[model samples]
Target: TQLLEQSPQFLSIQEGENLTVYCNSSSVFSSLQWYRQEPGEGPVLLVTVVTGGEVKKLKRLTFQFGDARKDSSLHITAAQPGDTGLYLCAGYTGANSKLTFGKGITLSVRP
Candidate 1:
């Protein structure tokens, strides 16, 4: 099984909609980060929660880390086309320091 998996690899919605993408794993992590990347740009860090049960919110986006530190979630409220992009979740552990990325969720919000 994959180390990390995300649901709904693709999402399409009208302007002013709401949606959520989930990241799940069987292995625990020291910390997990959420990132949003636009075409031709690097993935920008949206949120990073290290403690279990931690939650962070940025404008219309909400982030949550599972109590077991094995999963995370991102929820968007009143999503606009401007909010459209590639949503990715990454987990970090050990000396590798390499992030395990989700298959990627492509969100397209149309007006």
Candidate 2:
């Protein structure tokens, strides 16, 4: 079984500020994915990092997988009010593996 631990359960930041959220676990994973979700909606996948030490960028957001495949980080640059939402990290072990999600991080960006 895979378990993910996330830090900063809640974050309140002013617009244009920068922030970073982390997901970590002692178990190794085949891939890790990041997601964003808004109220009354399902989570939307932001990016998936498959290789250890791989990094992916989506606009002002950057996602990185640790070299050991046991951790990941999501950094947001110049946060905006529209970016306010819940962020989640999920890890997958294999094709038949169930995805394990961390306790979500709720971000509130103030204008």
lDDT of 1 at 68: 95
- Worst 10-residue stretch by lDDT in candidate 1? 93-102
> What is the TM-score (0 to 1) of candidate 1?
0.93
Q: 14-88, model 1: which lDDT tens digit per residue?
A: 999888899999989999998889999999988999999998999999999999999999999999989999998
Highest lDDT against the true fold, candidate: 2
Estimate every model's Cα lDDT from 0 to 1.
0.91, 0.94
Superposed Cα deviation of residue 38, candidate 1 (Å): 1.0
Give the alpha carbon lDDT tens digit for every residue of 1-111 in model 2: 438988889999999999999999998889999999999999999999999999999999999999999999999999999999999999897676788899889999999
Which pairs clash (backbone N, Cα, C closer than 3 Å) in model 2? none
lDDT of 2: 0.94
